[model samples]
Target: MTMELCYNPAAGERGLGDLYLPEHPEHAPVALTIHGGGWSAQDKSSFCGVSQFIASLGWAVFNINYRLTTIAPWPACGDDCLMAAKFLLDGEVPEFAGLDRCKLLICGGSAGGHLALMTGLRLPPNRVAGIISISGIDELTSDFALHSFRYEPFFGGEPTEEKQTEANPLQYLRPDSPPVLLTHWDNDQVVPVESARRFRDRGRALGCRVDYYEYSTEDEGHGIWIPDSKPHRLYPHLETELTRFIESVRPENPPCPTK
Candidate 1:
C-alpha cells in the first residue's frame, strides 16, 4: 500500500486529506472515511483504523479533515466534505486517478455520519454509489440531534427551523439519492437510534434503497470507538455486510476512469 497527502488549498489550510492507494489499483472501488467529534473536535486520524481496513480489501481510501466549529461554523464542515469529494471526482490528485467513479462510497461514524449524509444528498447522483452512516443524526430539527449542542457552536447560535430543515438529510431524500446503509446501536447515548430508523423508513417510502441494521445496547454500545465496545466483536460482521452491499450496488467490471 502507498499513502499520499491530498489537500485543497482553496478549501483552506485545514482542508487536508490522506489518501491510501493500494497496489494494482485498476478499477478499484473507493471509500471516503470521515471522523466524528461532534463536529467540534477530533481529526482524520480517528478513522485510521477503519480506513486501513477498507483499503486492505483492495479498495482506495481517503480519510479527510475539515474545519472544526472553533474555526468556522455550521455549513463549513459540510462544505469541506463536498470539496473533498469534488477534489477526488475532478481527478485533482494523481494518487487517486485509478479510482472507479461509479463505485465510490462514503462511510463515517457519529458527526462524520451526519456529514456523509449531507454530502451524499447534495452531490450529483453520478458522483457517489452508496453511503454508510454509523450512529448519524438524521433530523437536525430534533433537539436530540447535533443542533442541541454540537451544532450550536457551528451555527454561532440556534439554527432556525428552516435552517434545521435544510440541514436534515432525512427531509431531502429522493429517488436519485444514493443507497444508504445505516447501523445504529439501540443504546447510543449521543444520537438516538430513532434517527436512523426514521431515515430508513423515509428512504424506503421514497423508493430509495436503505439497508437498516440495529444492534442491542448491551452488545454494541453507543460509540464504535469505545473500549471493548460491541464494535470490536462486530467488526467482521459489519465489514462483511458493507462489502456485500457495495458489491451489490457497484457494476461488475465497471471500467475505472483515469485522469
Candidate 2:
C-alpha cells in the first residue's frame, strides 16, 4: 500500500508509516500491526516479516509506528494510533482505499501488544475485528506494569491500586468489543504471563471471543514465541490460528455513510 513519513504538525513529530495491500486491489480488508518496546522504544520497520506474511495471505496490512517516551509519551502513542486509524479508514492513501469502511485486525507483541489493545480500545466498537496480544499489560499503572516506575512519571505521580483498575485494559472492556487472541510463553522475563491472563479474564467477562495459548518451552525468548530454526510448523500454526479466528468475525458495525 503506502510507505511514507511526514511531519505531524499537530504532534510536532515525524511518524513512520507502512501499508501493504493485496495485488490488483480495488478494496480489501486490512490489519494494523504495532510493535512493542515498553512505550520507550521500537519501530514499525521491524515488522517487515509479519506485514509481508499477511500480504501474502491476501489481506492488506499496516505496520504503524508512533513517537516513543524518549520522544513523547502516553497520549503520544495513543494520538499516533488515532491518526493512523482515521487516515486508513478514510482511504487517504490509494493502497488503503479498499479498507475504507472495512474492518481491521490489530496485532502486536510485548510492548507492542499493549499498544495493540490500547489502540483498538480507543477506536470505535468492532472497528477492529480482533486483537493479537503477545505478553502484554492489562494495566498501565500496575506495580507489575512492564515499565515499572518508568511510566509513572509519564502518567504523573505514583500509580495507586484504585487507578490500577482504570489503567488496566480490562477497565476499558465493553460487551461490544471485538474478539481477541492472546499468546504468551510460560516464562517471559520481560512481560509476565499473568498480564495476558488478566486481559483474557476481562475479555471473557465481556463475552468476547478470546483464544489464548502458552508455549510450554522458552526457546523463543520474550517477544518471539516461534523460533525460526526449530521447525516450519511454528509460523504456520500462528498464521492459521489467527486467520481462522479473525475470518469468523463479520463487519456489521454501522459504517459512516459519508466517509
Candidate 3:
C-alpha cells in the first residue's frame, strides 16, 4: 500500500512523502529514498518507481520531496531530508509501527545523493544503517567554478571557501559513519567522478566502509537511475547491490567497525 503524508508540518506539501509498505510490514526494514534534480528541480514523484521496487524487496520505502534550492538554499534541502528520516525513526506514525527503526537505509541520486549523505552522516552514530549515493556531489570545494550556477544558488550566492567545506560530504567522514555505497560514471559531465573517488579513498583511510562502483562507459552520465533504460540500464546489478548492502547492515548483523 502507498500513502502520502507530510513529514514536516511547517513545510507543508514540500515536506510530504509517499510511503510504500511491504506485504508483511511487521518488523520490516525501512528505506528513505530522495529524488535528484541538481537540488533545484524534481520531487518525491521522481522516485516513485524506485520506491515501489524497494518496497517489493520487503522493505518500507519513504520517498520524499525536499525544499528545492531555488526556494530555499544550502542546508534547507539537507535539513528537510534529516527531518524526514527523524519522522520515521521516531515511530509516531501508525503506518510506521513495527518497522525496524534501527535498520534505516537512505538512498538518493545526484543532488539527492548528496543530501542523503549529509543527512545520514549528521545523525547520531549508528542511527543510519547505510547510505547509497549515485553520482552524488562528494566534494563541493574542488570544482566550484564548474558548478557555480547550481552551487551559488544552493549556498545563497557566491559561496565562500568555508561554506563549500561545510557542505562537502567528504568533511563529514568519520570512523563511525554509516557504510556508504557510492556509484558514479567515470565521465560524468555534471559532477566529476573524481569527487566520488576522493570520497571513497578518504573514507576508507578513516576506516569507514565505502563500497564504490565506477562505471567507465561513455553512454551513462551524471543522472544514472537504477532499472532505467534511457541513458543506460544497470537494472539487475544495481538492484542486487542495493539488496546485498541493506542485508549486510541489518540490526542482526554486527555494527561495521569504525576503526
lDDT of 1 by residue, 1-259 (tens): 6465656676565688878776657778777888888888988877777777677767778889988888888788898888887776665566766567565688887888899998888888666778888788865555345437565675878766777787888877898788889987778878877888888888998899899888764444354554654322236656677777767666347654433
- The per-residue C-alpha lDDT of model 3 at residue 79 equals 89
What's the true lDDT of residue 241 in model 3?
Answer: 77
Model 2 lDDT tens row, 196-242: 77777778877977788766653645635455532122355566766
Model 3 worst lDDT run, 10 consecutive residues: 250-259
* True-vs-predicted CA distance for residue 51, candidate 1, Å: 0.8
- Candidate 3, 132: how far from true, in Å? 0.5
Candidate 3: global Cα-lDDT? 0.81
**Could you tell me which residue pairs clash in candidate 2?**
35-112, 36-111, 36-112, 138-169
Predicted structure with the largest lDDT when compared to the true one: 3
**Candidate that beats the other on lDDT, 1 or 2, i.e. the better one:** 1
Per-model tally of clashing residue pairs: 1, 4, 0
Model 1 clashes, total count: 1
Error of 2 at 93 (Å): 3.3
Local distance difference test, candidate 2? 0.65
> Residue 234: error of model 2 in Å?
7.4
Ranking by TM-score: 3, 1, 2
